[model samples]
Target: MAFGDIVQGSLQDFVNIDRFDTELCVFIHIPKTAGSSLSTELDRMRPPYHNIHRKYFYGDTVTFSRIEDEIAAVIDSGALADARSCSGHFSWTLAAPIRAARPDARAFTFLRDPVKRVISDYRYSRTPTHPTYKETIERFPTIESYIEAPETQDKMARFLMPGDVRTPHEIDTFISTNYAFVGLLEMYPLSFNILSLLLGHDRMPSEHKRKTENTVDNAVDETPRLRAMIAECNQRDTVLYDIVRHKLLTVRDDWRAMREQSRPAA
Candidate 1:
């Protein structure tokens, strides 16, 4: 069966944020999916915010062991207890801990077309303005090499489904079950709708603007060969992307319906 077809319930059916004791918002950032823009907007909207990135936790080396302590310190300080929202590369790891401290915290994220996301990520990594530009160029001298690297394979699914999620079905179910919203990078307006719904606001902060990264040309030529190549490299990601796209549409429609229903004698 198709991945989207397998989902038996709507996203709202799985969401239960009203039951939380303390309110927190977590944005699980998947690279190259307009996550940076959303994070910036959320940082602007939500106060007492904590933003975590790989560099802050791991630096040039992996420090998986120290994550718990860092998370604990944030919890102990009661920063998370207050009205706070956090966005980070390590969002998935922080999700459970944040919820533990603040039972009402909601976690959400965005996904993009996997092929486009991979290409954007490669181009971004090579841009001089990017933090990891040196390391990326040193490691991946060419787009072909970058495409073949293990790091580029199903990166979104890998980050979102970090543990024992072995199949596309598991990934779909996990996201639907956990996240308050799964937004689309391409559908910014509708994605904003879902995000605003979760944020308990009618609109996002007016001061926040969409931040574009690595404005380099999109990495691929317009041709069947290039398109097929990118797709072949992202089979798993495509499945997850398709699922999110479908869910995002449903979520948006449902929200609109709710808003319409709640409207009084208009």
Candidate 2:
């Protein structure tokens, strides 16, 4: 599918990323993108409160099935009145209820390297730490086998679609329209710096940094062929990631120039 050029979102500028002007803000917490740590930080900083839907990082079969749809019921039941911010793993379409409730609420998300995130997610799922551990161990025994499953395809993009966004082009446009900001997990510190600007809050503490170790041993070898297959499954998410990274590059450059200019000269 064809991809679109990175059209910048409406919430940024040369020196500062504009904070959302509305009272309520929203976060689309995509999985395996350091979203949990970011969610914790977001919950700490929002004005009155930050609403968490399905706080568990992982769940059983039933939770996995209802995780994305549960937020809609809460919003429909008039639970949003006291909510200063909403965050969850809900699908891109499920956010419609929140948007309908607070038309002015701005949204944002953080993206990660598609390939790495898939690998990380697979590794994380294999352990007994999460609710789905038993299920994952029984079904998919290896990274290769995991990628072969339909459930493992383009997850990042899937959370953002179900609206004419099947192609890469639609993915970029959808983000530009739906989100006020996009951060990258690879540049975790810098991304939160942008988030700080967006929320007028202090930078998050370092303790919340994402864990980098791969502790799970699924007992199967991974090769170039396996990685290639994973990449192929996430073509559109790759497009989406690249588009945001490119825009962030521009932001970084502009920010550097502004800082250098402001420095006192000898």
Candidate 3:
């Protein structure tokens, strides 16, 4: 067969999965990376084929045991019989169980600059309205303390590729092998466009209509020292973000071209 025929066949298979297959698309949401907004919009943007979608937000309040129970129930009850997509702030650990339930699952996640993401996380955690505000303030009395905390270190790196394997090369390999998409928050509009294509959407969602507007908490003073501390602590995440950025830049034109080619003739 010609290479063009192979490409067309592959595109057809992809569309078939989106249309008829009983598979799940898992979104591994990294915090402060516009995930919540995407999660909200995804529900609205969901095509008719995937009407039974679910979103789960993993956090201090939602423990692994709780997730295991929920997942167990979902699987046991055959809830995944129909097409579904789920977004969550959980680690890659959930991938195994999810796939066990639905073998054809595909995963994707977003990454952001570690320094900025950490700063945004800290400031947001300080808000009185934030559920974890009290805990955050109590645990991290200062930005320095927050930056120095063990939990704040290489968060994206750890979350994206959990287990003993860590180095920059390994994380890159893991993402390449596992994730269908690795979006960068810095280039969210383009990333969203690409995401729409991957999910069989004709167009990207508007940036203005966010499900949840996660603004940077600008009132808090971000001094040079704090920025340096964040940078130093999240070196691994910085590397991962750079990898995602490069992937985005490299694939944009090609993906657009393929989408155009894959479209039906007028």
Candidate 4:
């Protein structure tokens, strides 16, 4: 039900930091994840929220370099203490300035199954609902093409990895070592409970701020070839997803009990 109960290792193996101890909690928002909904729940807790400007999302790549720079500047300007938490689509390195400014600040993020995430992202991109839908549609008309593009390769890794990290184990070590918690989209209930426990929440809100995937009407075919291509392109993301699943869901007796309860009768 909590971090100690669910996570594979002992709480002592990780940091003792939590909402009570930290000046700021950082939420590294990856696109197509459930961050918006989680952020809304964070809002209900009545803490000051800092959102990195979405304007960069609408701008070109020449500008992606500037968002964290601007945010890092804000941290340097001594603006971070006023906010309870900050959430954005910035890389893991964004935490560097925040941690320097507020040493106790903790960060967390959610990861999704790579193939499903891409399928959702592709469909999301073709619609006006996505911020850069027009450009996405103009550039990559097919799901295959979209998944094959360099930008789409390891979409999750783009936000998670900092330098030329080669393998998924490196990412696993990074998140496990740095992040306060890592939530899996497939196991949101357990993930949410762990988050609530660590954040010292008395009451938990389950409502999602928005369902972006519901906006897209057409579903991708998800043929065998397409799935394999998606796996190949997102090797790091895929392995990380599997690692989290095995770590959280396979080793624990509680998780096995939950699986048994949800299992179909023979």
Task: Write one digit per residue (lDDT tens) for candidate 4, span 1-266.
Answer: 21223354444232234444345777888878777788877665537777775453344541334676778767776667787877887878755777778776777778888888888778877776666667777788778778888888787777876767657667667666666777888777766655665666534447854655544433578899989999988888887777677766643455445446656799
Each prediction's TM-score versus the true structure: 0.75, 0.81, 0.76, 0.80
lDDT computed for candidate 4: 0.69
- Candidate 4 lands at a TM-score of 0.80
Regions of candidate 2 where Cα sits further than 4 Å from its true position: 1-18, 55-65, 76-78, 202-207, 210-216, 219-222, 258-266
Instruction: Summarize candidate 2's per-residue lDDT along 1-266 as a digit string, tens digits.
Output: 00111234322342143455345777888878878787777777775545546644543353443654566566667767767777887766878777777877777788899988898788778766566777787888777778888888788887876745866667767777667778899877767766665676546445474664455464435678876888898787798888788777756755455446546797
Q: Deviation in angstroms for 13 in model 3?
A: 13
Compared with the true structure, the alpha-carbon lDDT of candidate 1 equals 0.67
Error of 4 at 240 (Å): 1.1
Give me the overall lDDT of model 3: 0.66
* Model 3 lDDT tens row, 1-266: 11112123343443334331234677777777877677766666652222222343457662233555566566676655564676665678855787777777777788888888888777777775465566677788777888888887887877778766567788777777677777777878767766675666656556452222243432457788777878888888888888778766665566567667768899
lDDT of 1 by residue, 157-200 (tens): 77776657757788877776776667787877667654664555
Measured with C-alpha atoms, the lDDT of residue 87 in candidate 1 is 73
CA lDDT scores, all candidates in order: 0.67, 0.69, 0.66, 0.69
Q: lDDT at 39 for candidate 3?
A: 77
Worst 10 residues of 4 by lDDT: 12-21
Off by over 4 Å in 1: 1-22, 54-73, 94-96, 204-222, 251-266
- Which pairs, if any, clash in model 3? none
| Global fold similarity of model 1 (TM-score) | 0.75
